[model samples]
Target chain A: TQLLEQSPQFLSIQEGENLTVYCNSSSVFSSLQWYRQEPGEGPVLLVTVVTGGEVKKLKRLTFQFGDARKDSSLHITAAQTGDTGLYLCAGGRGKIIFGKGTRLHILP
Target chain B: GAGVSQSPSNKVTEKGKDVELRCDPISGHTALYWYRQSLGQGLEFLIYFQGNSAPDKSGLPSDRFSAERTGGSVSTLTIQRTQQEDSAVYLCASSPRGGGLTITEAFFGQGTRLTVV
Candidate 1:
C-alpha cells in the first residue's frame, strides 16, 4: 500500500508567523496536490504539482514538489487567521493517496 | 450540480445494522471516488469508478464494504453489519477524467458523517 506521511500534525501560531508542512512517501507519484479543509467541510484543492522539483505559489502560500516526486511541501508566509485549516497532501498514480494532514490554527 | 453531492449528511445507526451512502458526481465527470475519514485522520481511499466501471477497488476495507456506480453518474456504498470502526465521514469526489498518466484534481462533496452506536 502506498502511504503519505505528513509531519507536524498540529500547529498553532500567531498571525504573521510563517510555517511549513511536509509530506513524504517512498513511492513515486505522477502528481501531487495540496488541499485545505475547514471544519465540517470537504477538502478544497489548493494546487497540483506535476513535475519534479516544481514550485507553485498562491498568494501567501507556496507549494513544492520534491525532485523524486516522492515528497512535497507547503509553505505559508506571514500567515493570517483566515489561513487556519487542515492541510492535506494527495499523491496520484493510478489512484490518489492522501496524507494524514496538518491542522493549522493562526491566532490573531 | 456545480460540485459532487452526497446524501444523508449525517447518520447514526446501531451496531449490526446496515447503512447505505450515496454520491452524485458532477455533470460530465467520468471519474468518481469514495473515501472514509476518521476523526483527525487522512482520507482513506475506498473505491474509484471511471464511467460506471470500477477499475480500482483495492482500498475497500473488507467484504462488508462495497460500492457501485450506475449510469456513470450516481454511486452507492453499502456497509453491512456496521461496527463502531465504521464510524467516520464518508466522502465522495469526482474529476473530469480518470487519473493515471493524466493526473486531474478532484472536487469533493461535503461528506456523510456516519456514526455507529
Candidate 2:
C-alpha cells in the first residue's frame, strides 16, 4: 500500500502569518494534487502538479512538486482567516492517496 | 455544470443492518470512485468504476462491501451487516475520463455521512 505522510497535523497561526505544509511518500506518483476541505464538505481541488520539480501558484498560495515526484508542499503567505481549513496532499497514480492531513487554523 | 451529487446526506443506522449509498456522477463522466473517510482521517479508496463495470475493486475492505454501476452513470455502494467500523463519510468522485490509475481532475460530491449505532 502507498502511504503519504503530512507534517504538522494541526497548525494555528495569526492572520498575516506564513506557513508551509509538507507531504512526502516513498512511492513515485504520476502527479500530485492539493486540496482544501472545509468542515462538513468534500475536499476541493486546489492545484495539480504533474511534472517533477514543477511549481504552481494560486494568488497567495504556492504549491511545489518534488524533483523526484515523491513529495510536495503548500506555502501560504500572509494567511487570512478565510484560509483556515484542512489542507491535504494527494499523491500516487494521481488517483489520490491522501496524507493524514494538516488542519490549519488561521486566527484573526 | 452540475457537480456530482449523492443522496441521504446523512444516515444513522443500527449495527447489523444494511445500508446503500448512491452516487450520481457528472454528466458525460466515464469514471467514478468510492471512498471512505473516518472522522479526522484521510480518504480511503473503496472501489473504482470505469463506465458500467468496476475495473478495480481491490480497495473494498471486505466481502460485505460491494458496489455496482448501471447505465454507466449512477452507482450504488452497498454494505451488508453494517458495523461501527463502517461509520464514516462516504465520498463519490468522477473524472471526465478514465485515467487508469493515473490521476485526473475528479469532481467530488457532497458525500454521505453514515453513522452506525
Candidate 3:
C-alpha cells in the first residue's frame, strides 16, 4: 500500500506570515496535485505538477514537486485570512492517493 | 451538469439501516471516484471507475460498502447495516479520463454529509 505522509498536521500563524507544508511518500507518483478545502465543502484543486523538480505558482501560493516524485511541498507567502483551510496533497499513479492534510489557520 | 453533482446534501440515518448515495459526473467524463472524509481529515478513497473497464474496489472498507457506475455516467454507493463509524461526508469526483500513465484534473461535488444516529 502506498501512503502519503503530510507534515505539521495543524498550523496557525498570524496574517502576513509565511508557512510551508510538506507531503512525502515512499512510492513514486506520475503526478501530484494540491487542493484546498474549506469548511463543509469538498476539496478544490489548486494545482497539478507532473514533472520532477517542477514548481507552479498561483498568486501567493507556490507548489513544488520533488525530483524523485515521492514528495511535494506547498508554501504560502504572506498568508491571508482567506488562506485558512485544509491543504491536501494527492499523488497519482494508477490511482490517486491523498495525504492526511495540513489544517492551516491564518489569524486576522 | 456543469460539475459533479451529488444527491441529498445531508442524510441522517438510524443505525442498522441502509443508505444509497448518488453521483452524477460531468457530461462526457469517463472517470468517476468516490471518497469518504471525516471531520477535518483527508479524503479516504472508496472506489474508482474508468470507462468500461471493471471498477477498482480495492479501497472499499468492507463488503458492507459497494458502489456501481451505470453507463459510465452516474454512480451509486450503497452501504448496508450502517454503523456510527460510517458517518462522514461522502464525496464524488470525475475527470475526463484516468487509470493508466496519465491523469487529469478532477471535478468534485459538494458531497453528501451522512450522520448515523
Candidate 4:
C-alpha cells in the first residue's frame, strides 16, 4: 500500500506570511499533482508536475516534485485570506493517492 | 456537461438505508474516479473506472460500497446499509485518460454531501 504523508496538518498564519507544506511517500509516482479545496467544494487542481525536480508556479503558489518522485512540496508566498483552504498533494498515474492534506488558515 | 457533474448536491439519509450518487463526467473523458472526503480533510479514494470498466476497486471501504460506470460517460456509487461513518462529501473526477507515463489533468465535480442521521 502506498501512502502519502503530509506534514503540518494544520497551519494558521497571518496575511502576507509565507508557509510550506510537504507530502512524502516511499513509493515513486509517475506524476504528482497539487489541489486546493475550499469549503463545500471538491478539490481544484492547482498544478501537475511530472519530472523529477520539476517546479511549477501559479501566481503566489509554487509546487515542487522531488527528484526521486517520492515527495512534493507546496509553498505559498504572501498568503492572503483567499489562500485559506485545504491543500492536498496526490501522486500516481492511473490510481492516484492523496495525502491527508494541510488545512491552511490565512488571517486577514 | 461543461464540467464534471454530480447529482443531489446534498443527501440526508437514515441509517440502514441505501443511497445512490450519480456522476456525469465531461464528454470524452475515459477515466472516472470516486472519492470520499470528510469536512476539512483530504480525499479518500474509493474507486477508479476506465471506459466503463473498473480497473481498481481497492479503495472501496467494504462490500457495502459499490460503483459502476456505464457508456464510459456516467458513474453511480451505491452504498447499502449506510452508517454514520459514511457521511461525507462524495466527489467525482474525470481525466482525459489514465495510466502510462503521461500526466493528465483531472476535473472535479462540486460533490454530493451525504449526511447519515
Candidate 3 lDDT at A59 equals 97
Q: Candidates sorted by lDDT, descending order?
A: 1, 4, 3, 2
Give all TM-scores, in the order shown. Answer: 0.97, 0.95, 0.97, 0.97
* Segments of candidate 1 deviating more than 4 angstroms: none
lDDT for residue B11 in candidate 2, whole number 0-100: 96
lDDT of 4 by residue, B1-117 (tens): 599999989999999999999999999999999999987778899999989999899999999999999988989999999999999999999999997675578889999999999
Per-residue lDDT tens digits for candidate 1, residues B47-76, read 999998988999999999999999999999
Deviation (Å) of B69 in candidate 4: 0.8
lDDT over C-alpha atoms for residue B34 of model 4: 96
Name the better of 3 and 4 by DockQ: 4
| Model 4 stretches with alpha carbons more than 4 Å out | none
Separate DockQ for every predicted complex: 0.74, 0.55, 0.72, 0.76
Q: How many residue pairs clash (N, CA or C atoms closer than 3 angstroms) in each of the candidate models, in the order given?
A: 0, 1, 0, 0
> Could you tell me the TM-score of chain B in model 1?
0.97
- Which of the numbered candidates is closest to the native, going by highest DockQ? 4
Ranked by TM-score, the better of candidates 2 and 3 is 3
lDDT, residue A28, model 3: 87
User: Which pairs of residues have clashing backbones in candidate 1?
Assistant: none
* Displacement of the residue B36 alpha carbon in candidate 3, Å: 0.4
Q: Which residue pairs overlap in candidate 3's backbone?
A: none
**Highest-lDDT candidate:** 1
